[model samples]
Target: LVPPDILKKMYVLRRILNPMGTVDAIEFLLGKLRETKVNAEFFEKMNT
Candidate 1:
């Protein structure tokens, strides 16, 4: 029931949500929002 333009935006959002996706302005913004507070333990837990 969604419009094509909205669906396209959703697809773009999905791509940006990919944790290891290619770097770009959106990814840079996401990284900035991280506050440099994520720890190695968090990554270790995710890797499991």
Candidate 2:
């Protein structure tokens, strides 16, 4: 059980380490989802 603060910092570190940030990953995933006719509820639930 990681604290939210630690999780936030980890997310920041991950973004720093990743050449492409989470937004890019989200966009790529969203594109793939579009091709698969993903549900609207899934999009609504997506944090991005």
Candidate 3:
């Protein structure tokens, strides 16, 4: 497996290669993850 540092550099290079698309993709994933976390927390609170 690739080392974490090399993997990070590869991601940076990919972002540099396609800046707008990369940013948009990252934002979309972050938003989806945030929504999932909020929903999970809401359910957990309800279960308590």
Candidate 4:
């Protein structure tokens, strides 16, 4: 297992190595833990 500090660094390094507009889930989780703000809107239209 990697220490959180070191693991975070690893994630950054991995992203630097391959930043092809793909998501890096680990970074997303880290951001969430840090209380990153996210906004979403949803609309549903149905006729019954």
Which residue pairs in candidate 3 have backbone atoms (N, alpha carbon, C) closer than 3 angstroms, thus clashing? none
Sorted by lDDT, highest first, which candidate order results?
2, 3, 1, 4
- The C-alpha local distance difference test score for the whole of candidate 3 amounts to 0.54
For model 2, give the 10-residue run with minimal summed lDDT: 39-48
Give candidate 3 regions above 4 Å deviation: 20-48
Candidate 1 has what TM-score? Answer: 0.39
Total clashing residue pairs per candidate? 0, 0, 0, 0
Cα RMSD of all models vs. native, in order, equals: 12.3, 8.6, 11.4, 13.8
Candidates in order have lDDT scores of 0.53, 0.58, 0.54, 0.45
Tens-place lDDT per residue, model 1, 1-48, is: 975655665566556567654666577646654744564332323312
Sorted on TM-score, best first, the list reads 2, 1, 4, 3
**Cα displacement (Å) at residue 5, model 1:** 0.1
| lDDT per residue (tens digit) for residues 1-48 in model 4 | 865655566566556547534457566545544552432110011111
Question: How well does model 1 score by local distance difference test?
Answer: 0.53
Candidate 4: pairs in clash: none
**Residue 36's C-alpha lDDT in candidate 2?**
50
Error of 4 at 48 (Å): 54
Report the error of model 1 at residue 32, Å. Answer: 13
